[model samples]
Target: MIIRSATSDDVDAIWELNRQIGQYHFENVPDVFVAPSHLDREFLLAAIMDEHRLFSVAVDEERIVGFISARMDINENIPFVIKRPLCRIGSVVVDEDHRAKGVGKKLMEHCSSWANSNEAYQIRLEVMSFNSKAKSFYESLGFKPQSEIWAK
Candidate 1:
C-alpha cells in the first residue's frame, strides 16, 4: 500500500468513506450527528488545496483504502495555558473491508510525519465514546486523553 497526498481525483472515494463513518456516528449519536449526504465536492476540493491542511489517502492495488485529514493550528490563547502548535486530526476513515489490515495506522503515521515536519508540538483527535475499537486503535498508538466534553 502507498500513502500520498489527496487530489481532486480522490474526492469521490473519500466522500464515500466519509459517508460510511458519518452514518455510524449518526446512528450512535443521533443528538449530535445527522445522516450525512450531499457533501459539497467543492468544499472537499478546497480542503485539498489548502496549504495549512493535509489530506491524504492510502491506496492499495490502485484502490483507496483509507484517508486522513489534519491541520496545524495554535493552542487557544489563554493566560494560564502554554502556547504551542498542534496538529488536529479532523477525520480518518478506513474502508470496512480494509480495517484491521493496518491501513488506518499507516494513514495516521503519515499524518504524524507531516505534523512533525510542520513543527507541531502535539497531535489530537476525538473519538466518540461508543467507538471502542477506534479508541483502542488510537490508544495503541500512544495517545492519551487530555480532556472530556460532557453533555446534558
Candidate 2:
C-alpha cells in the first residue's frame, strides 16, 4: 500500500469516505442523535489548502483504501486556556473491508509526526462513547481521554 497527501483529485474519494463514516455513526447511534451535516467539497478543498492541515489517503493499485483528515487547532478554545497549540484528529476513516490491516495506524503516525514537527503541544480526538472499538484503538495508540461531551 502507498500513502500520500490528499490532492484535489482525491476529494471525491474522501467525500465518499466521509459519507460512509457518517452512516456508520448514524447506525451506531439512535435516530435522536443525528449525525452532523457534512462539509461540501468546496469547503473541504479550502481546508486542504491550509498549511496546518494534513489530509492523506492510503492507496493500493490506484484505489483509495483509507483516509485521514487532521489539522493544527489554533482556535479550538483549548489553547486559550492551556496557552499551547493542539493538533486535532479531525477525521479518520478506513474502509470497512480494510480494517485491522494497519492503514489507520500509518495514517495516525503521519499525523502525529506532522503535529510534533509543527510545534503542537499535544494531539487529541473525540470518539463517541458507543465506539468502543475505536476508543480501544486510540488507547492502544496512547491517547487518553482528556474530557467528554454528552449531548442531551
Candidate 3:
C-alpha cells in the first residue's frame, strides 16, 4: 500500500471517508452529537492545502483504499498539559470493506513516524467516550486514557 500526501484531487474521497465515519458516530450516539452536512468545512479545506499535514490514499492498483489526516496541535485543549509543539491525529479512516486488512494500521504507522520526526512529542486525539469499539481500537494501538470528563 502506498501512503502519500493528499492533493486537491483527493478531496472528494477524503470527504467521503469523513462522511462515513461521521455518520457512523451519529448512528452510534445520536442523542449527543448530530452529524453535520460535511460539505465545504474549513477543516476539510485545510486538509487539501499545505496549511496542514495530510496523507491520503493507501492505494494499490490505482484505487484508494484508505486515508489519514494529521496536523500540529493548536489549541488549549485536553489535559496532556503539553506546552511544546505536539502533533495531533486529525482523522484516520479506512473503507469499511477494506478494514481488518491492515490498511488502517499502515496509515497510522506512517503518520506516527511522520509526526514524531517532525517535532510532535505527544500524539493526542479525542474520541467519543460512548464508542467502545473506537476506544478499544485505540487502546489496542497503545493509546491510554489520560483523563475523563463527565457531563450531566
Candidate 4:
C-alpha cells in the first residue's frame, strides 16, 4: 500500500470510495445525510482544488482503496478564546474490503503530517454518535471527544 497526495486524475476513484462511506451514512443517519448521488464529482473536484484543503489517497497495487480530506482553518475569532490554526478532517473512507488492514490509519497519518507541515495546532473530526466502529477507531488513535452536538 502507498499513500500520496490526490490529483484531478484521482477524482473518480476517490468518489467511489466516498460513496462507500456516504451510503453507510445515508442508511444510518437519513435525517442528516442524503444518498451518495448528491455528492457529485464536481463538488469533490472543487474540494481537491481548494488551497486550504488537503486530499490524500491510499493505493494498493495501483488501485485507490481509501481517501481522506481535511482542511486547515483558524479557530473562530472570539474575544474569550485563544486563536490557533487547526485541521478539520472532512471525510475519510476505506474500502469495505480494506477495513482493519491499516489503510485508514495510513491515510490519517498522512493527514497529520500535512497538518503539522501547515502549522496546525490541532486536528479535529466528527463521527456520528451511532457510528461506534468509527468512534472506537478514532479512540484507538488517541483522539478524545472535545464536544458533542445535540438536536431535537
Lowest lDDT 10-residue stretch of candidate 2: 31-40
lDDT of 3 by residue, 1-152 (tens): 78887777777777777778888888887877578575535567676686557566687666677888777875477667656777777777888788878888888888888887887778877788777766877887998987787877
| TM-scores, each model vs. reference | 0.95, 0.85, 0.82, 0.95
Extract clashing residue pairs from model 1. Answer: none
Q: Which residue runs does candidate 3 get wrong by more than 4 Å?
A: 36-43, 74-80
Model 4, 1-152: lDDT tens digits are 99988899999998888888888999998999889884568899988888668888899999999999999888586878658888999998999999999998999999999999988889999999989999999999999999999999
lDDT of 1: 0.90
TM-score of structure candidate 1: 0.95
Error of 2 at 11 (Å): 1.2
Quality of model 2 by C-alpha lDDT: 0.82
Candidate 2's residue-wise lDDT over 1-152, tens digit each? 88899988888877777777777788888664556356556766776676668888899789888888887766645554776778888888898888889988988998888889989999988889888888988898999999988777
lDDT of 1 by residue, 43-133 (tens): 6778888877999999999999898999988858687975788899998899999999999999999999999998899999999989999
Runs in model 2 lying further than 4 Å from the true structure: 30-40, 75-80
Evaluate residue 59 in candidate 3 and report its C-alpha lDDT on the 0 to 100 scale: 78
Model 1 is weakest, by summed lDDT over 10 consecutive residues, at 37-46
Could you give the candidate ranking by TM-score, starting with the highest?
4, 1, 2, 3
Give me the runs in candidate 4 sitting further than 4 Å from their true place.
none
Question: Model 3, 112: alpha-carbon shift in Å?
Answer: 0.9
